[model samples]
Target: MAKPFRVDIVSPDGLAWSGDAEFVVARTPEGEIGILADHEPVMASLAQGVVSVDAVGGERIRVEVEGGFLQVLSNQVTLITDRAVIEK
Candidate 1:
């Protein structure tokens, strides 16, 4: 099993998600950023798109995110945005 990282998605309105994820894929200005457990430090500007995550239990989750910033360090990923809606 792979390590899990903490992924927090916050919108200016409120907290969107706070949980553990095995992997995450997001659309960034540079293209796409994929994060796994214990990934190296990284910072990228996000674009208007969908942010997807593979849950610890293997289920896939996606959230619509507006333009924002993605910060990756150690085992943490902070997604700061102004708008985000979790897919049901």
Candidate 2:
């Protein structure tokens, strides 16, 4: 099982979601990237698409991002976007 890492999804409006997740899939300008706990640090430009996060308690959270930036470091992931909406 993957260890949980801190993840925060934020938009201009405010913080959309913040929690600990075991896995995260995000679409970057280069391609789709999967993140796990203690992954190598990365900073990338996000593409307009869905960012999927597997929460610690088996809950899956999906957020629609209208392009932004993603930063991963020290078992933490932070996504900043101009606009984002959580998908039900």
Candidate 3:
């Protein structure tokens, strides 16, 4: 089993979501990127699209973001965006 790591999605309003996730996929200016536990640290510019989080419990949470930045370090992923909405 893949190890879970922390994931936080935040917007100007506040924290959108924060929890343990097994995987994450986000849209970036360069294209889509997938992140897993122990991923190499990285910082990237986000594009307008959906950021998907595969939660530890097998739930998939999707967040629609306008634009922002994504940071991954020490088994944690942080997404800071201007605006975001939780997609049903």
Candidate 4:
């Protein structure tokens, strides 16, 4: 299993979610991408779609985003979007 990484999501309004996650999936202009711990650094423009985060202990978090940017570096993931809402 991959190690957990810190994940932080933010929108124009404010911070949406912050937690430790094992994996993440998001839509980008190029296509969908999955992130794992210890992965290579990346920064991409996001497409309008749902962002899925697999948190520690098998919790799944879903967020709807209008548009944003996703960045991964040093085992930290950050998402900044124009708009975002966490799904119940």
Best prediction by lDDT: 3
**lDDT per residue as tens, model 2, 1-88:** 7889999999989999999999999999899999999899999999999999999989999999999999999999999998889999
- The deviation in Å at residue 36 for candidate 3 is 0.3
Each model's C-alpha lDDT? 0.92, 0.95, 0.97, 0.95
**lDDT at 9, model 3:** 96
Error of 1 at 54 (Å): 0.7
Residue 22 miss distance in model 2 (angstroms) = 0.2
lDDT for predicted candidate 2 compared with the true structure? 0.95
Off by more than 4 A, model 2: none
Candidate 3, residue 52: how far the Cα is off, in Å: 0.5
What RMSD does model 4 have? 0.8
Roughly what TM-score does model 3 have, to 2 decimal places?
A: 0.98
Can you rank all candidates by lDDT, best first? 3, 2, 4, 1
**CA lDDT, candidate 4, residue 27:** 98
TM of each candidate vs. truth:
0.95, 0.97, 0.98, 0.96
Q: Residue 51's C-alpha lDDT in candidate 2?
A: 97
Better of 3 and 4 by lDDT: 3
| Candidate 4 per-residue C-alpha lDDT over 1-88 given as tens digits, one digit per residue, 9 for 90 to 100 | 6699999999978899999999999999999999999989999999999999999998899999988899999999999999999999
TM-score of 2: 0.97
